[model samples]
Target: MTEVGILGTGAQVPDRVVSNDEAGAAAGVDDAWVVRKTAIRERRWAAPEQATSDLAAAAGSAALRSAGITPDQLSVIVVATSTPDRPQPPTAAYVQQLLGAVGAAAFDVNAVCSGEVFALAAAEGILTRRGGHALVIGADVYSRILNPADRRTVVLFGDGAGAMVLGPGRGARVRNLALHTFGELAGLIEVPAGGSRRPADQAALDAGLQYFTMDGRAVRSFVEDRLPLLTKQFLHDSGVGPDDIRHFVPHQANGVMLDALFAELALNRAVMHRTLTHYGNTGAASIPITLAEAARSGAFRPGDLILLAGFGGGMAVGFALVEW
Candidate 1:
């Protein structure tokens, strides 16, 4: 089997910074409440003209540059996102065009916040057979779908993108990957309208069904229950252990949840990487964004074991073990 690995990583966020005060004002809360609940001090909001594709393209370009690979060398471009530019065309199409990756096959993956790892697994498989580089980007513009008055979600999400270039190289070698989904719990986090089942109409609009909604308590319970078990199983199946991991880069869902998870996982030697303090939960962008920041800062040592985990809507969870 061909050995594929991450060649580079990049991240991009909108210039507009939305402080907790700003996010909470309309949500009937205050900065203190938000910080206490989510540990989010601020987040980035996309400009009116920015969309998911734009951010994905920018991040992809950076990844390509860091990898020293030109756009035309890309064999595939996978964009993992839920808040796409439109309901029809795959957002990867726009990203491909913007990046001038004309020959690369492009598509989108909608595993909600778990999309990045899903996309990474997909790209890794393709590259193993196709023998070329792939750009995997996770981007979202949650600010567009959020309900201003919904304190549970509005204060927990932001707009941003993160990306990685994968190919046969000497970077972080992917050791194993795992993904899971609980379809029955899909309703725990979703936009109730605008899809085939619930069309966006006047009634749905009036009911505010188009906005993002989540059973926050239930979702938290799910994570608290499943994450540790899954992490242990994943490590065991991969012939590793929690203590073997040097770094844990998980989805920037919530700081409080992550803190608890970190403690429970007992990866005592591992340093948990988090960007949610300022970026909030940027949908699928969180993991890669956090990973990119750490990589750029010279955080990882050669041959270090790194774990990437993401869990979110679709009630899905994805994990990837990497040798950095």
Candidate 2:
């Protein structure tokens, strides 16, 4: 079997920044309240003219450049996103065209916030099977789906994208990857309409059903109950322990949830990397964006153990253990 590893990473956020004061005013709250609740001081929102593909392509191009590879060298392009440019074509198709990846296979993966890690696992499988480079991108334009008046969901999401170049060569070796889903709790976090189950009709629009919705308390409870078990299982399967991990990059959910997770796992807070304070929750893009930022900051050393874990709206959990 061929070995697959990450060669490079890149991330991109829209030019527009939304500060907590701005978002809080819209939510009828104060900046202090917003920070106290989520620990997000500000985040980036995509311009009206921009779409998910735009962000994905920018990040993908950067990743390719970081890896010193050309578009033609890519064998596959996997974009993990729920917020596609359109319902007809996969967002990956538009991203591939924009990046001029003419030789690569293109598709989309919808694992919501756990998307990037899921895409990484999928890309690794493709590379190990086919012997070529793959570009995996996770991008989302949550602002488009946000109900401006709905503070809970609107204040928690932002728009951004991240990408990784994976190939069969020496780099961050992917030692173990795992993904699981709990469909029973899918409705805890989701867009109530815009899908086949409840098409985007005037009634849906009138009811504000097209907007994103999340039961934050329920989500936290779910995480508290599920994450530790999942982490234990993941560590066991990978034959590694918490102390062996030099860095624990989890989904940029928020400060409170992350703090709770750190306590639940009993891991050192210093080893945890978080981007939510500045970026809010960029959905699928969170994990990779944090990973890219950390890589650029010289956080990893050779032979270090890095753990990537993400859990979100599919009620999904995905993780990867890498040896840097």
Candidate 3:
């Protein structure tokens, strides 16, 4: 088996800062309390004109640069996002163009917040055949669709992007990947009326269902039970125990979600590095965003055990065990 370890990672947060207070004023939350609950002082909001592909391109460029490879070297480009620049053209196409990935085939994947790991799994499937290298990018600008007045979604999300390059392998790659979804809970955190379920129009807008909504209490309960349970399940399935793993890179859902997960895993907060406070939840971009920052900070070493996990809409969840 080729050792398909991660070659490099890159991420980009937006330029403007939306402080918790500012977000609170806009979203109707207690500013100080929001900070304490989520450990988010502020978050990056993309420029009004910025598109999801733009962010993905920035991250992809950085990832290719770090890997010392040109875009032409890649065989595939997988972009994961729910909020794409356009409803039709796959967002990855634009990113490939920006990265000069003229020869690489590109497309998009959508699993909401679980997008990064989902796309990575797709990348692994292609490389497992011993044929190619790939660029997996996750970028989202939920703020664009968000109703600025909606407190639930607005404050918990921001714009950002992250990417990683998957090289040809018979290598020690992602050893195991598992996924689960329960569409029954699809109503928990979702943007109703946007798609076929209830097509958006002047009527849906008047009904106030055009914006995203979350049954916050229900999602908290869902995360509380699943996060810790799945982490342990993944460790066991991979034949790895808590002590055997060097790092836990989880989806940056929110600080509240992290606080619950860390406690359940009986893991110290220090053992699991986080970047949610700085960028908020970039949906599928969260995990890789943190991974890119950690790599640059020298937080990882060769031969380290890495666990990448994510969960979000489609009521989906996924995990990947890799040797870094």
Best candidate, TM-score-wise?
Answer: 1
Worst 10 residues of 1 by lDDT: 124-133
Instruction: Tell me the tens digit of each residue's lDDT in model 2 across 1-324.
Output: 689988999999999989988876767877788888888899999998999999999999999898888999999999999899999799999998999989799999999999998888888888887789999999999999987777787778889999999988878899999999999999899988888999999999999998889998899998999999999889988998877888999999878888889878866533888888888999999998999999999999999898899899989999999898
Please list the C-alpha lDDT of all candidates, in the order they appear: 0.95, 0.90, 0.83
Model 2 misplaced regions, further than 4 Å: none
- The TM-score values for the models, in the order shown, are 0.99, 0.98, 0.94
Per-residue alpha-carbon lDDT of candidate 1 for residues 264-297, written as tens digits (9 for 90 to 100): 9999999999899999999999999999999999
Higher-lDDT candidate among 1 and 3?
A: 1
Q: For model 3, how does the per-residue alpha-carbon lDDT over 1-324 read when each residue is reduced to its tens digit?
A: 444556778898889988887877766786687776777777899998799999999999898887767888898999999998977889998888888887888999999999999999888788766556789998999778777776767778889999998885422267789888879998887878877778888899898886777887788788887777887988898997877777888888878778778767774423687888878888999988998998899887777787888899888898988786
Better of 1 and 3 by TM-score: 1
TM-score of 1: 0.99
Clashing pairs in 1: none
RMSD of each: 0.6, 1.0, 1.9
